[model samples]
Target: MRAYLALLEELERRRRGNSLAVYKPYDRQAEFHAAGATNRERLFMAGNQLGKTRAGGAEWAMHLTGRYPDWWVGKVFDQPVRLWAAGVTGEGTRDNPQRVLVGPPQQQGEWGTGMIPADAIADTVMGRGAPGALDSVVVRWGGGGDVQAGESVLSFKSYEKGREKWQGETLHGVWFDEEPPLDIYSEGLTRTNATDGITIVTFTPLLGMSDVVLRFLSAEAIQGLGSSPPQGGVAA
Candidate 1:
């Protein structure tokens, strides 16, 4: 009985300490990851609090660290990537996507307990203005052999900052945690256009058929969504 209890405790410890080690995406998550290969811009539209944000975080973690699960079949970056993960405000980002990727904002000691493994977390730079918010993270990318220094950077941004903040930098990818205004969304897409990088947006339909939502609900995309359950992502 003692051994069994000890084993259970250890498993729980591992699960919390390095959540990424046990990450197993559901059917929809796998489908979303796989869809990234063909679709440059994909929208994961689902109900709020339904793991859409979690999916985005998991994929972002994989890309930033260049550490993909053996069963992963989604988009894979050959080298370490420069990516952005954003939400509505500093607090919203800190509470959701940021937490998902880097663990609890309040608990700096448990930083790597999120989707990105602890050892792979190279460093974190605190963002300005926002209290207890992270500006960016340096992840050790296990970019095998040919790839350089093996480090990738993940930056945090907010839609409230406007589209200009999103300009300038050429990104490997962008993950939008919630529905962004059309213009902001366009700017994000442009950032990746030069590199042929991907743009992934995961959000609920709060805008109710707004431009951003409409873009993903094209005739074909709508048809795809209706016909049987999609594994992940609908091309737009």
Candidate 2:
């Protein structure tokens, strides 16, 4: 009885640890993160339920909070950042990136049970149309000498809103939850151009030979970025 009770306590603590504290990605995921050190844009193409989306969410959390695990060998930001996380539609955005980053959109009580640590979430702006969708989340960034220096903002968007919505702000990073339209992909790249920020696209190559797909798999891209894995992997 005593040992069982202690086990339950350990589980509860891990439940709140969140993001990098608990994200132990497989070999493919780690290679993807490591590639971020030199590459500004990367693509992780994989099959469904292979932990690709979770890895993306975990990396973003580390960037927002500037809290990298000891094993982390990826890009690190020294200050608070403004980033965008998007999908093909509002609902898709909510279900994938939003769900992994902030928890279940449909469950209000479980909002903090995601890659972002519960205590690190400072505030959240609810989305306008979709039920329980989030517009943005303010994360408590800790890179500054003081914890109160400033907070990072993670805005949610959908490609369905078009390239116009993607214009304006200079972002620190952008996470494309899935493969996006070539035009939408271009706009996302533009948003991060000024800041020299990173772009992460995690998706399955359903649209075979598409422009976005070609961009990552082309020989030119292979030479520019590092090598991809044998199985489903990353093209930096």
Candidate 3:
């Protein structure tokens, strides 16, 4: 009897823990960029802690788990997606992008507490690099009563692995949590070309006028820049 009560309490806690309110964009800019983005390639470039990474991570969670909120107006996939989330190095990728997508690297028990709801997490494959980091995660689609629902895969990648490592696989989406080199970025672009897949980048423009930054800037300029960084806008 005691065990049964404990189980019920645990389940209740998880139910309340997965509320969408925990992950909503903090401002209009974040809301617009995360849900309003229509471009095939989108860049959320801003200064530190302005919710750039948070917006990107939230959108990616929606895409991967197929659990979009009612307010979502961004790109939607009819089927399960295969995505790559990348960063500057193995440790950085694990600590930042991977952490945002699936929770803390060192805390396996806390895996489902990030942007991904606890119930949507299907399984995780452990990676060899960076202690307790994940190589990939499988997200269970709620199906929403549609026939296309299933498990979506999120793979962890590193820019330090080079352009060659980015080659070959055809992906549904790619999220770069940091500005990647031109060659690596180009390789990522190629992987998504066949599927008309989307590429989302979230970064601080600390590199100033680098090639990757210039690509987004040349087409459309970032707006409303202030001391604290643009909250959550996207430039494509």
TM-score of model 1 (CA atoms): 0.87
Deviation of model 1 at 65, angstroms? 1.1
Instruction: Candidate 1: list runs displaced more than 4 Å.
Output: 1-13, 143-149, 220-236
What are the models' TM-scores?
A: 0.87, 0.89, 0.85
Instruction: Order the numbered candidates by TM-score, best leading.
Output: 2, 1, 3
**Runs with alpha carbons beyond 4 Å of true place in candidate 2:** 1-14, 17-19, 143-148, 220-231
Against the reference, the lDDT scores of all candidates come to 0.83, 0.87, 0.78
Of the two candidates 1 and 2, the one with more favorable TM-score, higher being better, is: 2
- Minimum summed lDDT over a 10-residue window in model 1 is located at 227-236
lDDT of 1 by residue, 1-236 (tens): 99999999988767776777777777777788888877888888777667898888888988988777888877888888899999989888888889999999988988888998887899999988567799999999884666665889999999999988988999999888888999989999899987889989987766655678667666876565564443434444
Question: Residue by residue across 98-217, what tens digits does model 3's lDDT show?
Answer: 777778889887787777787888899998888977889999875776566689899999998788888899998898898899898888988999989988888877766667766765
Q: For residues 160-205, could you state the per-residue lDDT of candidate 2 as single tens digits?
A: 9989888889999999988899998898899898888999999976
- Report the C-alpha displacement of residue 234, candidate 3, in angstroms: 2.8
The model with the greater TM-score, 2 or 3, is 2
Note each model's CA RMSD in angstroms.
3.8, 3.8, 3.8
Number of the top candidate by lDDT? 2
